[model samples]
Target: MSINELTKKLKNEAYSSLYLLYGKEKYILEYSQKLIVQAVLDEGSADFNLSSYDMEEQPIEAAIEDAETLPFMGDHRVVIIQNPYFLTGAKVKQKVEHDLKKLEQYLQNPSEQAIVIFIAPYEKLDERKKIVKALKKQGEVIQAEKMNVQLQKEWINHASKEANVKMTDEAVERLIELQGENLGLLIGEVNKMALYVGEGGVIEPSIVDELISRSLESNVFTMVEHVANRRIDAALRICYDLLKQNEESIKLMALLARQFRIILQVKQLKAQGFTEKKMASILSLHPYAVKIASRQSRAFSEEELKDLLIRAADADFEMKTGQRDKQLSLELFMTGIHKAKQTN
Candidate 1:
């Protein structure tokens, strides 16, 4: 199940006998776990009914034992099993043994009074494993992967609704600009905004600008856009702003070079008939970011993208080698981009 679907189910108080929560996104996984706990056990019963076990220290058998045990003062017990590394094929740092057969047996016939949640913080589970197949067949599974842009926007809307506040379109965009795709950070910022704006109030661009601090990656995106649009003055102003904030010019140049390379890669992939979705997957970038970069890439020829990357590299080398002032090197690189843009 998608994270949103699982969230809806939990909200509806539709409890499952068994759950397999695995994901690369720690925030989503953790949030979902909390929802399940809330749905299964009441606040008063939580202390006595909730049981947690680290699979690394205490094997699956131990958790299964706890699951089989009756709740002390409640009708239902919640057993949370963390770091079920056996679900994935990745090698562990230390050899922590797990009894997979116990989990498989529990999956075949889970406890009616218990909700066993297997937390696997892994990118992908080993589907070929019998335990995995059994769990999938018998329980609810939520894969908390990085959401695409539309889903992300929907999530923001949902969060706003939950907070009893409204976020304007521009506010949403600005929040995304400040927070990027980290849902944990975004949610925190949203909660603060919702409180600041008060109940039923709309969060606008000014509120966002006042509350949120710009991330380095977000500024890099802006700088790249400015460069792509040949807005040299705005681009240099951003650089100066970064420098005033004690950001190293070499570090900024590296980020610019990385963005340029992504643009170039996106361009080359597009030329070879790759879709935006495919390019995003290939580049391991957020689809929204890939979309924005795709638009920026069209403003520059392939040669221009390469020229910018080369200039960024030259600036990096000159500054690192003490051949030029660090700030001046970056300034020169921006000027080079302007000249390249003019020529192109």
Candidate 2:
């Protein structure tokens, strides 16, 4: 089932007998698990009804047996089976023997009075297995994956609505620019901003600029933009700010190199008639990031980008070899690039 379907079901107190929550997105996976528990049992009854087992150390039959049993004092029993590695194609040495037959039998006839949840934190499951096919047929499978740009914007809007505040489109865009696509951090920042704005208040771009902390990578991206625009003073100011925050010069240089590399790649790919989505897939980057890089790539020719990369490598070598002061080497690299742009 989709997350929205699960949310609607939980809203109406409609509980499912079997749930297979598997994903790489830890925040969504854990949050969904909590929501299920909250919907299945009250605070007082949770102590008696909720049971968790680790399949890594314990047998699957133990969890299946618990699921077969009735609740102690509640209407339903909730059994959480964690780290079911056998369901995947991984070759992990078993610490304990699991009765797959028992699990298969339980899936064929799950207890009506129990809610069994399988939490498999994996990218892909072994679909070839009969047990996996049976579970898919019998349970509600929720795949938690990373959200794309549009989905992320929708999530921000939903979060704002939940907080009883309104977020403008510009504000949402700025939040993504500052926070990147980490959903957990984005939600936390959204809640904090909501509290500041209070109920019935609108969140604007100015508020986002004032309240949200800029990540190092975001700062580096901004610095590169300043360089591209020939605003050397603004770029130097950002470098100083990061230095004041005790950011190592070597780390900053590495990020700078990475940013330049991305811009060059985006430029080359765009020249080849590649779409933004296709470029993101090839580069293993978010589409939004690719979009930004594509725009930035216009400010410099391919030759300039190649030169900057070489300079960055030379600066790195000098710093690591103790041939120059690390901070001085970074400053020189930036200023030298600025001068080269002006001369050209």
Give the candidate number with the greatest TM-score: 2
**Per-residue CA lDDT of candidate 2, range 144-187, in tens?**
77777887887788889989999999999999988898888888
The TM-score that candidate 2 achieves is 0.94
**Candidate 1 ranges beyond 4 A from true positions:** 2-13, 228-233, 244-246, 266-282, 298-301, 339-344
Q: Can you list the residue pairs that collide in candidate 2?
A: none
lDDT of 1: 0.86
Distance (Å) between predicted and true CA of 172, model 2? 1.5
Tens digit of per-residue lDDT, candidate 1, span 319-342: 999999998888888888888678
How do the predictions measure up, each by TM-score?
0.85, 0.94
Pairs with backbone N, CA or C atoms under 3 Å apart (clashes), candidate 1: none
- The regions of model 2 sitting more than 4 angstroms off are none
